[model samples]
Target: MDMRALRYFVEVVRQNGFRRASATLHVTQPAISRAIGQLEEEFELNFLVREPRGVCLTPEGDVLYRRASLILQQADSLASELRDLRSMVSGTLRVGLPPMTGSTFFGDVITEFRRQYPGVQLQIIEYGSNQFAGALSDGHVEIAAAMLPIEGEGFLTQTFARERLALLCSRDHRLAARKKVTLRELSDETFVAFTSDFKVNNLIDRLCNQEGFEPSVSGRSSHLDLLVSMVTSGMGVALLPVTVCRGIRSSRLRVVTVIDPVISFDQALVRHRDTYLSRSARAWIEIASEVLGFHVDPVFVA
Candidate 1:
């Protein structure tokens, strides 16, 4: 059967009327009806029932609907892959990155992607997660590494990793050597927090509120390393991802776990829901899944 006819059938089922589907597909009702008639004739079955309200699909039509959706997704990915092989000898991808994981966690993924697609240029823009989400929705970047539980719409996300948020303090601080500390223990401590631009600041505030006190913000910065360094210099303590703390080896700093409802957040590959992803973008996400997880959603290419 023709892919265009299958698409018309799917859209008709989704919109629940041939007329509505015609409007959505920017075709006349006669054209849609003719396509559906051709499909039914080719398959030798009545796949739809007409009523006063609209059209309803038969059992056979439902089966075709599910399979056709996957086939269309596969077709798009294959088409993109072929285009990458033909005309895109070289291409540039603009990516949004949060400052926290931008420097430390993505080294291997970026290096491997570069090794495989040497001709593709990567333009990395560093922003806090909260700010980057807006850029992503506005078509500013192809994809982003975002911290979850993101609060918004018009985004599709696949979780790649989860890490606990650890408390970092100067070695000379009174609680530095402790293996773990409860939230109440640090109730009065001044905090060097990520600004509102970073989602972690919101997480910190929410958790602290649950613990019955608002953390007094002593300093603010978007850079993770800079925030951790501030803690090491005895300005104030900070909460950071454990993976980030592991990347920095400093004898003057201590990394301790937070208890009384342990704090953690997921890291995900995020993009606009309706965006058209390129071959290079899809390839980068696949490589990142290899680095961070066993697999990601394969249908993301569509």
Candidate 2:
């Protein structure tokens, strides 16, 4: 069967009638009907049911619709991938980032990259943890900055740096006087926590679970700066990455190390195995390696 015929058949099913599909495809109604009829003849199946309101898919048509949808999607993706190759250094680089970490180094890297390749466009998307992983998986982004231990196959990841997670509180809070505090010591205090969607919050939950006590969460914020504001305002204490603490230069807040066990999370750049990364994307990856002072293996290209 001709691919064009298959496309015409799919369009007919989508629009639910020859008239609608013909209008959409810029063809006559009879032409759309002829294409679907040819497809049905080639496949040896009745693909649609005649109805007064609109055409409905038969069982065979439903199966073809599912497969056709995937085939069309893959074809479009292939076209995009081929287009990306011809102009690898000049197209847009879609990047996803978390709010808390990597902002400092990423800003400088982006600036330097733009200076070097002004033709390349940058689309930076800030996503919460719940959305970041899915966005990367669905091809919404070419690369994303994420915390480590991403489970699954068909994904390439490289650790850039390890950030220490510290306990932060307002200077006037009781725990602020200490340079170091244990998880057990903060059991009684009201915690201003990151949302459960974040990896930092997961780490805190695991650590607190290990300590055999659930934290008393007084407040939760998605933004690191907002969480710091809450802590500084004496609403509650928070567990935050050291990178985030660097931004809180206020005298009202103090950073304390978690003793007994120092908690840290590895920051990584993650990409899909099948993604066709542009030259500028690879360049930014190298810049990130330089900024973090680590060597990482590039994803295989074929």
Candidate 3:
């Protein structure tokens, strides 16, 4: 049996329809149908039942699905292992990172990774912490940086860094005079928050709840610069990473620590435990661990 045909069949089953599988695989629907049809003909059994909404698997199809999945996983592992046997590392490493805080944590790691591994192409996918799990599961990214503790099983993590959340407001604002403030003090202040999909928004929600009042949100944005701009314009105050707030060059904004119950989150490098880690991916983790986690020189490659 053709491995390509097996892949097509598995994708069709996973997607529940030929059209969706075709879209995912970037192949034509007729091509996927032909491949699955060939598989059924080879086995001399009907594997799927055609329906208006989608396709359903027969008992034989279910068995084939389970077995084929293992086979594909093993096949991929074998290929990765063979590649590792080479003396040099040269492959694409796809990594997912949050839009706002990712740069603060990974900018140096990214620079060092590229410098050390010029043969490997690095692909950085921007995803919020909330989306990292799905992105890693879907194979869109091989590894990711996320806020810990990442939910769910079948994943492994290495601690990246820990940081406290700080408050940003216009320099002229009433609370700007203080070097530190608590969530309760800002209970009545208008807030500029991140979009719902960002995990920082979740952090904000929890902090507000702990302080006994909900934030009166006046603006929401995905970009840190825009959020800062909103705060600078006196639209509302924003909560951001202390490091990020400190890096802002604007004299019009105040970066104050949040206390009385300091809001903080741990960051980590996460990946599917079952997925094969290419040399490039391993190198990335090494550099990140050295620079961001251990604060030492990386000796993994040389």
Which candidate has the top score in lDDT? 3
- Candidate 1 lDDT over 209-289, as tens digits, reads 989999988899876667877898889998888888888788999998989879888888888676668878988888888
Q: For each candidate in the order shown, give its overall lDDT on alpha carbons.
A: 0.81, 0.77, 0.82
Two-way TM-score contest, 2 vs 3, winner: 3
Rank ordering of all candidates by lDDT, starting from the highest? 3, 1, 2
* TM-score of structure candidate 2: 0.73
RMSD of 2: 8.6
TM-score of each: 0.71, 0.73, 0.75
lDDT of model 1 at position 272: 69
Tens-digit lDDT track for model 3 on 207-279?
Answer: 7888899889998988888998999999999888888887899989998889988999888788877777778
Off by over 4 Å in 3: 1-78, 293-302
Q: Across residues 28-138, which tens digit of lDDT does each residue of candidate 2 receive?
A: 877777877888898798989979988889899999877775566455456556766787567677888888775764877777778877887888977765556655655
